[model samples]
Target: MSRKEKTWWWVAGIAILVYCLFPIAWIVSVSFKPPADLNSGGFLPDNATFDNYRTILTGNAKDLFRPALRNSFGICLIATAISCLLSMFAAYAIARLDFPGKKLILSTALVVAIFPVISIVTPLFNVWRQIGLYDTWLGLIIPYLSLTLPISIWTMSAFFREIPWEMEQAAQVDGATTWQAFRKVIVPLAAPGVFTTAIIAFFIAWNDFVYGISLTSTDAARPVPAALGLFSGASQFEDPTGAIAAAAVIVTIPVVVLVLLFQRRIVAGLTNGAVKG
Candidate 1:
């Protein structure tokens, strides 16, 4: 490529990076600002304080924040585990075994994945109320499966298709039982794909706001995103912007850490699955 082309690409990359990170930078800056400086419209506050963090962490807002955090962790983990487990088995079957309706299953999953979530929320709301599952962690987990399972099946199926069938056959021929061969041979080779699917599923369950808010009336099962919407400041007249910013920053930390820690695995899993399949 010409030097001019390289220069333009560099400029474009830097611009995109800034565009993505600018909101996060602003949130972090706002979180540190005192309530007085919140509306000052400055990129950096003249005076910064830890009061917002303190309030949400140890003061008045703890009641809401703590339970919401717990609910988020519990619900997302449970949903992700369930989704990945079901998706793993289904994906394995689709990738390795020829079945009568295999193409139909994949097509159905695609349809479900692309279906508008809002279209089903109202019906789900009534059904949950009738079954008494509304406002419970299990309530959230079930719907999340609908969201996570399709994509996970698609992702892991691609990964599974790339695995050598001979490896499993060789293990079987070596006197290993079918289950033993699968457990001992297939799973180890597919670990990266499984981990990547789990992460994707977890992110979907964790960040869901529509169901989180619409289904739960209280903190009992409300996740952080829904809880953040309900947050209030010291007075009704006071803007909760700084406190909300602090909470947003705190909520983002785990996602950032997960990406930084497993970035290579995520990239490899995606690229390998994409190219091989």
Candidate 2:
């Protein structure tokens, strides 16, 4: 490539990076700013303080933030686990076995994944209320499955298709039972895909706002994203923007850590899954 082309590409990459990271940087800046400086019209706070963190961690807002964090962790973890497990089996079958209506099944999953979530929220709200699952952990988990399961099935199925069937057959020929062969031979090879799917599923469940807001009315089952809307300041007249910013930063930490730690696996899983199928 010409030097001009290389320079333009570098400039474009830097611009995109800044565009993406600016919001996160702003949020982190706001989190550290004192309440007085929150609206000071500065990118960086002049009198940054840990007070916002302190307040949300153990001050007045603790009652709201802590429990919501716990609920988010529990609900997202459970939903991700269930989604990955069910998707693994379903995807394995779809990838390996020649079954009737296979293309139809894949198409259905694609349709569900692309469907507008808002259209079904009303129906789900009424149904959950009737069945007494409203405002419960199970209530959130069930609806989350609908969101996470389809993409997970598609991702895992693509990954499964890349695995060699001969490995499982070799294990079986060695007198290993079907279950043993699957557990020992198939699972380890699929670990990266499973882990990637779990991360994606967890993110979907964690970040969902429409369901989180519409389904739960209280802290009992409301995740962090929904609960953020209900956060109050020290007094009724005060804005909770700083505290909210701090809480947002806190919630974002886990996602950043997950991505940093498993970035290579995530990239491999996504690229391979996209290409192989």
Query: Considering every candidate listed, which one attains the maximal lDDT?
Result: 2
Q: Which residue window of length 10 is worst by lDDT in model 2?
A: 268-277
For candidate 1, lDDT tens digit of each residue in 59-142?
889999989999998999999898988998899899989979999999999999999998899999999999999999988989
lDDT of 2 by residue, 82-188 (tens): 99999999999999999899999999999999999999999999999999999999999998999999999999998898899999999999999988987898889
What shift in Å separates residue 144 of candidate 1 from its native position after superposition?
Answer: 1.0
Candidate 1 has a TM-score of 0.95
lDDT of 1: 0.91
Residue 184 accuracy (lDDT) in model 2: 92
Q: Which stretches of candidate 2 lie over 4 Å from their true place?
A: 273-277
Could you tell me the lDDT of residue 247 within candidate 2? Answer: 97
